[model samples]
Structures are given as structure tokens and as C-alpha cells.
Target: MNKIYTGILSAVCLDGSPPAYHYAKGFGEGASNWMVYLEGGGWCKSEDTCYSKVQNQGPGMGNSYKKGNQTAFDGILSPSQTMNPNVKIHRRGARVFKAIMEDLLAKGMRNANNAILAGNSAGGLATILHCDGFRALIPNAARLKCIADAALFIRGKDLPGAADKRELSFATIVAFHGIDNFLPKSCTSKMDPGLCIFPENLLGDIQTPIFLLNSAFDSLQVSSCFFQNLLLELNSYILCIHFRTTLLKTIPEDHSSSRGIFIDSCYYHDQIYFNPKWIGPTSPKLNNKTMSEAVGDWYFDRSSFQEIDMENDFPRDCTRDT
Candidate 1:
């Protein structure tokens, strides 16, 4: 087995508080290869029940409440779901994350050659957002990749920008989701302007091999199919896989399980991509997997798993075809 070493880097967002990235040292170590895995953009924390933690922590500590206040607060406060209305504040976090990633790559802590850029949910969106920034910082040819799990929200215009730079080549993009839910419903509705549409618009910009996984019962599956059809229509190089399964219904009486539902659906931003076996068959309703497993499966399933393709250019559909 290939030996792997891991390091964690904390990036201070525009808010000045640091967010972290788990950087693995041994990825492509033998051949000077590297990969960057960006976490999703929901409240940036790594725990199963982040919202509950926020509620238990009782605000003030991490934006759940104003500092110096003492009150039992509802833990559902988020930039997206809130009406206070400061859109730029939310974007600031993404910019800070990009800055930190660039700094790490330039400092040689992250290898530029054979680098795989990846993320789930909001993290997946960030991967696409930061693609151009990564290229500008590291001019050397590197393999850019992603594993976006049910992440299709767009904050602003749906057009591809620096992240879609032509110089960068995608190794593959593996997107996963359930059917009943994918991105927030607001994003899909034409009535809402602030909602995201980038996920749908991104289909044409993706030029490399693409794999999409979806559950039959998931609403996100519908959105995934929409994008897949778009790619198929254009004859783009995208490979889609659908995992058809019935979602287990949860019992309302179970409190512990109710918390789990909130964790899976809300806090993590729907990045949970796990196998049903590991989570156990008993809790089929809550059995979930991580993005890592899904991405690994996609790569291994490919015919040319051993070699990396660096010559492919960004799809011109974003410019000419659109």
C-alpha cells in the first residue's frame, strides 16, 4: 500500500477567523503529485451534528450568537437561510479560502504537479470557484479534479470565470446526490434571482470525464439528470452513473435519529456520501457515506486509472456553445 502523510492548514477567512483544510502529504508523493480537497461551504466545521453543537455551544463562540450574550439560541442561523441580508459577507469566506489555498501551493506545502482539486457540497462549489486562482498561482500543468456531492448553488451570475480558465485541465468531475433533495429548492425556481444556477450552467464548461451518481428517491437526482442530459446533448465528455435505491423513511418518535436527519440534510450541506453497509443496514434511513469513497469509486471505475491526462482544455461551450 502507498504510505500517506496528512497535514492540516487553517485558512483565516475575510471574517479573520481561520477555516481548515485537511492536506494529505502522500498523494502522488512518489511522482511529485498532489491533491487539494476543499470541504463544503456550509457552516465550516467537521462534526456530524454541527448545528446541534452550535446550539449546545450556545452561540457567541462561533457566530451562532453575538459575543457577550447569554441566551439559549436556535442553531439554524446560516448566511443562506437568514434574512439579515449581507451577501458579500458570505462570499468573503470563499475568497479567503482561495487565498489560503494559493498561499499553500506557492509555499510548496502543496505540490503543484499532478494536483487534484476536490470538494463536496459548498466545498465542491468552491473547487470550481477557485480553479482559476489555482492555475494563476501554479502555472505548471496540474490535474484539476472534483467530487461534488449534491452541490449546485450559485451566488451570482452563472457564467464561468477565472475558475474556468482554459489552461487548466480536469482529470474528472464526480458529482453525487439523492433524488428528493439536491440543491436548495430556491436555486431551481426561476422566481428567485439570488438562488444559485451555476451547477446547471457548469455542464458545458466541463470538458473532461464526468461521473454523476444519484439515488432514485432523491430530488437532487432530477437536477443531476438535467445537467447530464445537457452534457449528452452537446456530446461533451461526461460519464454519468445513477444509483437507484429507495430512501428509508425515518420514524418521527426517535429524537437521536431526528438529530441525525438534521445533520445529514442541513449542517453538512448534503455532502454525506457513504455506503449503506458501513453505516449498517438497521438505520437505512440515515445510512450515509463520505465523498471520499464516492470519488475513489469513480476514479477506479475508469479504464485509464493509472495514467493522468493533462492535455485536455476547458470546454469551449461556456464561450462559444452558450
Candidate 2:
């Protein structure tokens, strides 16, 4: 696999270090295939600092800190724990995401036979926002696949050129969201006002297969439900599965629950708002079994999915028209 680094608005500061990308060797090893992962949050300077601030703020502020210094919490009913210490935390910023995508394309990722875009939380939103650019940069034969965990509820209008860019017309689009959290600030001005207008604008044009996940016990689940409702109403070709039951609740009590999975500590005040039962999974499979499994399967096998015909379903520049 070929790898390249694209600079975002500025360099990402993770644990006080610059951001970097790891392109796994595969696509070029056999047949060409590509997979990209995005993370959630409002573009923190560094992973450690981001977590430290959350810890300082306390649990309820959306930054849950497990006792073990884990950055992520398990999706199970147990108390939240620390993320993998060895795992490299990338800067979660929109510009960083754009740079990554651009870098991948520059490295010939766009020419692959298959492509997959995956992310948790804000990263998921970034994938959706950057899909159009991927389409423009890659060859037509390259299949596009998306795996969004606790994602969706994003509005295309919020993106830089969402007004003019087309909704991501991928072969498959899968999304997941917690039942307790609300849409991120990027999605709306306030939590109560309702759905972001951006998702509405692109709903009709999305032709990929969509999978939805939510827990009944989670507050964010309500927002996921609202998102599902809008997609269904738009007569979209989305496949949604909602988990009304959950054994655990996510921690760090903020809108970007999954995004804060890498912090080492939480502020005392934030702890009051955190749900101890929310823990990060030991493996990606355990995080959210259904979504993780589906994503893995999609990433390897492109033949199982079908691509969208952009000309008929989506407007050339719906973002601008909306």
C-alpha cells in the first residue's frame, strides 16, 4: 500500500506531537482496495490535552475518563476504562480529515478497485463531508463504501461546499449512534431545535445501503431515531437497525462520547456527568459488534454491495440549491 501525508489548515497536535497517517499495506499487495477512518470532536490540539481537558471538565461534559487511563470506553455495561495506550491518537479536525483524504488520493488510493470510508463520532461526520471530493478524485470503477459508528445527524449545508457538492453516492453506507447523546454542535445550533437542515438536503440523493444503531437507554438514541425518520420519509434507500437495548451506556457525557475514547483522565466536575457503566471495548468487534462486523465485511468484499447512479437521484449542486 502506498501512503502520503496531506497537511490540513495547520498541523494536528496529538499528545503534543504532529499528526500522522498509517496506510496499511494491502490494496497494491493484491487487488487495489482502500479504507479510511475518521474520528469525532471539535478539532482538539492533541489527544492527551483533549482528554486532560475533558478530565478537568468532569464526566458529564462529554469527556468520560476511566480509572485506568484509557482513552475510550467499552460499549458494554461495565465501567468506562482507558483506551489502548499503544494506539496512536490522531487529531480530530475537519481540515486534518480533508488533508488525509487528499493525501490518500495523491498516493493513488482513488485508483483502487474498492474504497471504504469509516470513522467513529466526528470522524464519521468527516467521512460524509469529504465523500464528494473522493468521488471527484477517484476513478469510476473504484467502489466506495462507508462505515459510520455512532455517526449520522450531520447536515451537508454545514460543510464548506456542501451547498454545491453532491451527496456521497457510495456503494454502501452504514451508520451507528448512541441512544443517549445529541447531535454534535457541528450539526445544529442547539439540541432541541430538531434535525439539521443539511442531512435533509442530501437524504433523497443517498443511494447507498445504510445501517443505523442506537440504544433505548441512550439520550442520543432519540436523535438517531429522528435521523432515521427523516431518511425513511425521504424515501431513501437506507437499511437501518436500531438497538433499543444496551448493556452499557457511553461515558464522557458530552455530545462526542465516542470521540473522547483516548483520554487518560477526567476532571472531577466532568465525572459527575459521566456514566461509569460506559466502557471502551477491548477489541473493535466488542465496541459495537453489529456495526464493527458489518464494516469489516464490507471493507474486504466489494462485490456484495451496489453503487449509486448519481445522475438520476442526486442534483449536481444540491448543496448550493438548498
Candidate 3:
């Protein structure tokens, strides 16, 4: 893993602090293609929530570039200097992303022919938020795409009570993070920036090809589709069904061939980036294709594609032991 210290970058995180992203230089043929992944933990809805977030992350939001020590990185940031688990600081996502790209441009990403800007969970949402910016960076690239994993928070019919509270959270986030200032002006102009932050509103403005990767029964959504007050537990199944329908409908059909979607019945959040879920004989199979093969085929334009799993055919519950 190539570590680009935040101190050398142009942007600082929300707290006026520096945070680094774990970067891996592509190899061989892969060298010409770039993959920039955003790390996601969750979001900060209020000033207090933001403060609590820093506290939870300890000094330097887990590891400090100021310390001059190789703090461990995991998940997609894994196989690094060491392994240590830490919570993510959400408000800083967009800025961290901008800085990462600036450093990559200075390296050799400018000569790349293809680039995949992707992330899972919160990272997935960030991929959508920053997709346009990334495309602008490589205006001459032959192909540039965005992949959102389990971050497509399914929008649906009027789900009152808890749903209203969730909307409130969105409002808080927009103000807390100054999301309106950077969001697509057209989207925020027509509606609240809080609502504009959703892919449902921003998808139309994104000119880049996008791939949506999610689970029919996303674990994270089932638990907290709303706030702690709206814990649906297992009964959130209804919500998932409606949300998927809305997501499928929202994707642009104009350039249908350029778009791709993969949703399985597995009860998991982010899968493709993790080894067990990506590939291997024992991995979760969708039409005899592992996550890696499906993504490769779609991103590389190897075949026509769109996969959705039903509960009856593969009603398999995902267990960590698998």
C-alpha cells in the first residue's frame, strides 16, 4: 500500500486536521487503470455528533500522520503496515477525497486510460457525491466510472414517523457539512440540498457511467434504515423491497448499455471489496458469477449485464463464518 500523508496534500478534513487514504498502485496492465476507493464509516448529523465522532476515533482519528509512525490500515485499506480497527470521521470524506485525487494526479493517474471511483456503505454515497468531480479531473480518459456499493439508500413511498426523522437527519447533515455549497447546483436549486444529496436527485446530473452494487436485504438498512427509534429488525424486509424498486426505476435508462447493477439476496452491507464475498469457489454465487467476475465483465464491457436475486431461489443468510 502506498501511503500519501495528508500533511502533503492541499485539503484538510472537517476538523482542520489531515487524514490519509490507503492507496495501492495498479500493476502491469492494471497500472494504466486506476481505482480510487473512499473509506466510509457513517455520518455526522450535528455539531455534538461530530464532536463525539472525534472522541471515538481517539488521537488523529485513530492514526496520526503527525506521529510519524506506520499506523495500521484495514478493510479495502488492508495488507498495509499493520492492522487496527478504528471508526471513520464522516464530515471529512469529500475533502479527503479531493486531496487524494490531487496527490494521484501528481503521481501518474493523469496518463490513465480508465478509472473506477468507488466505495462501499458511506464510501459508496461519497462515490456518488464526488463522481462528477472525478470525471472532470480526467476529461480525456477513454472511460471513467463510479460504483456505489450498498450506499444506494433506497428512496420509497411516504414512510411516515421514523422516515420523517430520517429526513431531519439529512437536513442536519446538509448544514453541518456545508453539503449545499458543493452539491450539484441544479439539484439543490430545485429542491433542498438535503434531499439533493440523495442519489435519487443527483443521478440525473452525473454524466459518468455508474454501477450499483447492493443487497436486496442490506444488513445496515435493516437495522437502522432510520434512527435508533425506528429499528425494524427483521420486518424491514418490506422497506427493502420498496427501496430496491425505487432504485431500479431511478437509474437512467437513456444510456442503459453503459449502466450496470448487481443486487443479491445476501444479508450484507459491503461485499465486493472484501475477499470472501468477491471471489472463490465457496463465495456467494449469482448466476455462477462471483462479485469480482461480474464487476470485471461489466466495467470492462465484456458482456450485457444486470443481476438481481430473489429470496426464494437463494434465501441464504450471510454469516460471518462463511
Best by lDDT: 3
TM-score for candidate 1, residues paired by index:
0.41
lDDT of 3 at 137: 93
lDDT of the candidates, in the order given? 0.35, 0.36, 0.68
TM-score of each: 0.41, 0.40, 0.79
Error of 3 at 18 (Å): 2.0
Cα lDDT of model 1 by residue, 1-322, tens digit: 1111122133233222334444445534435666566554344232223333343432112233345544454355533323232321211343345555665665573555555555565566655445545555555644444444444442112222213421111101211111113333443354222122244434334433333321222233222323434444764433212111111121112222101111122111243333331132321222233333334544444322111111222221111111
For residues 1-322, could you state the per-residue lDDT of candidate 2 as single tens digits?
Answer: 2322334336443322334565665734645777776545433334464556444442113222335454354555334323223324333333445556677676777677777666544455455445555555665634665554444343333322222322221101211112112334444444322333233323233334322222222223222323434433664422112222111121212222112121111111111111231222322122333233433444455223211111222112111212
Q: Rank the candidates by lDDT, best first.
A: 3, 2, 1
Which model is ahead, 1 or 3, in terms of lDDT?
3
Q: Distance (Å) between predicted and true CA of 247, model 2?
A: 19
Worst 10 residues of 2 by lDDT: 264-273
Candidates 1 and 2 compared by lDDT, better number? 2
lDDT of 3: 0.68
lDDT, model 2: 0.36
